[model samples]
Target: MTDEAIRTERLSKHFGRTVALEGLDLEVPRGEIFGFLGPNGAGKSTTIRLLLNLIRPTSGRAWIMGVPVGDVRAAHRHLGYVPGDVALWPQLTGMEILTYLGRLSGRVDTAYRDELIERLRLDPSLRARSYSKGNRQKVALVAAFMTRPDLLLLDEPTAGLDPLMEAEFQALTREAARRGQTVFLSSHILAEVEDVCERVGILRDGRLIEVATLADLRGLNATVYDATLDGPAPDLSDVPGVASVEPLPDGVRVTLTGPPGPLLERLAGTGLVKLRSHEPSLEEVFMTYYESPARPETGLTARLDR
Candidate 1:
């Protein structure tokens, strides 16, 4: 009913001296697919647990579809979640596990469930004990998706899935968005996130470092242009928006930040033989924040804005 599928205010969690999550303030709009990205031990799972009310936060609060997380039954009623690692009763078949979970959720569209099973290529007849990790992941995905809840909280949802299955997962995510479902996807797979997510939040060391659209993030970083020339390279160090220009054996590698117009204008008369431009991949942008020593409260996006 609420416009926001999820909202958190300075949410934090700690394990004794260890801070699992700290001062996290985030809001996910209804029908949006939001990506939560961070490396291991970055408190991604901790944040999800707090949202699910599986663990209490040390400070602050969160709400799921207008219900406070403290009210577990009401909050959970609007969402379905799949953990990073799945475990099923070894004696039960995949179908049984799905049926039990469906009952626990208080809702299930059997037709949709069957469709998901088929699309994911899951054999529900197999015993859980005999299923490989990928198969187990498939089962969990089906269980979470079948209900068509207001929000789907997935942490590493594609961990053991092969490329083909990963593609299917992306398709499912798109379909969910088309049906106006919000998906909170926590993953380290940059390519998958880039392919499916409209916006992403990057976390580091239990802190939310950045949150923005992928295009915005890419715009903030430098773009590399490798140009091969028939003549000597021109001096482009003083050009505006030019971060650096390194001379190559044949030409020069120009690192431009804002726009290509200025750089292109400068290289127009320099006998441009061949030119190739490289946009920073999402992985590169992620690494810039991940590998940075400074943990600025405002994040790189803020600094880049100035």
Candidate 2:
């Protein structure tokens, strides 16, 4: 089997001149947790649809499990997918829905299915229409996970889930990765991606702009440092690798985007009564890119600069 479980080249899709996806090139290696990140209307759902052969691409190609997506039956057996917005048989119970989907995948492990149901704390007896948004997401999750396919494609899988359930979902993702299953997760929830993904691809305006590991991104923007001195802090505006410096009530706060070694020494020389470093949240990191008008120009290179 090829190391790349999923590959797409210049994948483009348009809806009456409204471009849904534009020249997207992506790869997902086998057994890795790859994050497909983008905000709403960024073509995340459209890309997944093309990969599933539910919709034909306007241009370019895609492969799933080494088989072209055009061959629906050949690729279908190898994948387990959970759509972002689920529309199920409202009259049916959650148990029935999961069982039906699992059976269609040509697998029937009732014990395993029940185990998943119990783990997710889903009340299978209730009709789908009565379930809340989070419960509906749980039903889809149980159905997808029970199939035990080689590849899993999840779209915003944790939407509406409670904190406890979200943590459980993260654990499930790690377990699947350990079992050598490839996961293509699409989400706007940055923290969840940071927790579960090994590499992430960011999309904006229908274009994929950056791809990098979490550690690499953190290194690009090191922890912010806040310090207060007995006197006014020395000017750090001219220092290299320092993105911005702002005055604070106590002293000053510095946002460092590169190595902190040189900057630390510079600050140490000034003498400090107290010092504190704060790591930015995923949202803060993501916003840095979104707020910037200039493009990163290259995949890995763009991420480091941002």
Candidate 3:
């Protein structure tokens, strides 16, 4: 069994009468990129704050590297974090800010810091106020990535990055994973999550509703298949694995759940001349959760350490 970098059990928080997080159970395994996804007002930031122990939880437990969250200093030692919105001293240079954060992590090695600066393409002389949104974001990323922590908690990590820089960010994340670092990345970008995350947890109304691998999610939804047959198309209404089938004069369309292997084999017997298959987007899979109360197959992988 893989060791977990972070675990939360029935973790909850309330701001007076307003509920922020309710029983948010999550697990991030060592050396894996775990994506935390939700829309606006879905309690993503609240959960991060709770895990950092910046605010006390109303109920449940949160642990970092098997240690309680309340032991903030000790727990933070093995972690690096980049917030969605960065606030920095207007007068301070980017390098100065990074150095400060590095110092906070207990040691400031010049060689590693310089390597991060070079990789991020950041200039040390530029003041915070002079930087654009992308540059500011880079500053924060450089700060966190420079530390080389065992785990990374990134919230809206690509907020201001352009396509090229976003690609660079993805490369950096994969590099971290290669080196056995755990990442819990929060994002609204479904495509980004699908690209890098091994598993994802979808949160709604402050509660975790689903957790699944990208392949698993793709398999759960309808897959589009278009096929051309030599003879008049056969009625595929009763075909197993197919959710819907549309028949045309020379071809047929079918949608299926789970693997396409069995469906392809069956289509072969139909004298198919051409066949095509397509998987749905993350948005489509997510819609299924909202369409009803039914949850994904990987319901809960972690117990609230409470």
Clashing pairs in 2: none
Tens digits of lDDT, candidate 3, 1-306: 338898999999888888878998888889999999877667888888887888899999999888899998888888888899988889999978887777777765678778767777778899999998878888888888777888889999988888888888899999999999988998878778888999998877778877889888777677778888888777655556665566766788766654677777777887989987777667546544544223344233222211
Error of 3 at 16 (Å): 3.0
- Weakest ten-residue segment in model 1 by summed lDDT: 297-306
lDDT (Cα, tens digit) per residue for candidate 1, span 1-306: 789999999999989999999999999999999999877778899999999998999999999999999999888889888888999999999999999999998799999999999999999999999999999999999999999998999999998999999999999999999999999999888888999999999887788878899999888777878999999999886677665556899999866656788889889888999999898788656544543333235333321110
The all-Cα superposition gives candidate 2 an RMSD in Å to the true structure of: 4.3
Q: For every model shown, what is its TM-score relative to the native structure?
A: 0.83, 0.84, 0.79
Q: Which scores better on TM-score, 2 or 3?
A: 2
Give all candidates' CA lDDT scores.
Answer: 0.87, 0.82, 0.79
**What ranges in model 1 sit over 4 Å off?**
227-275, 291-306
Residue-level error in angstroms, candidate 3, position 87: 0.5
Candidates' RMSD to native: 5.0, 4.3, 6.4
Local distance difference test, candidate 2 = 0.82
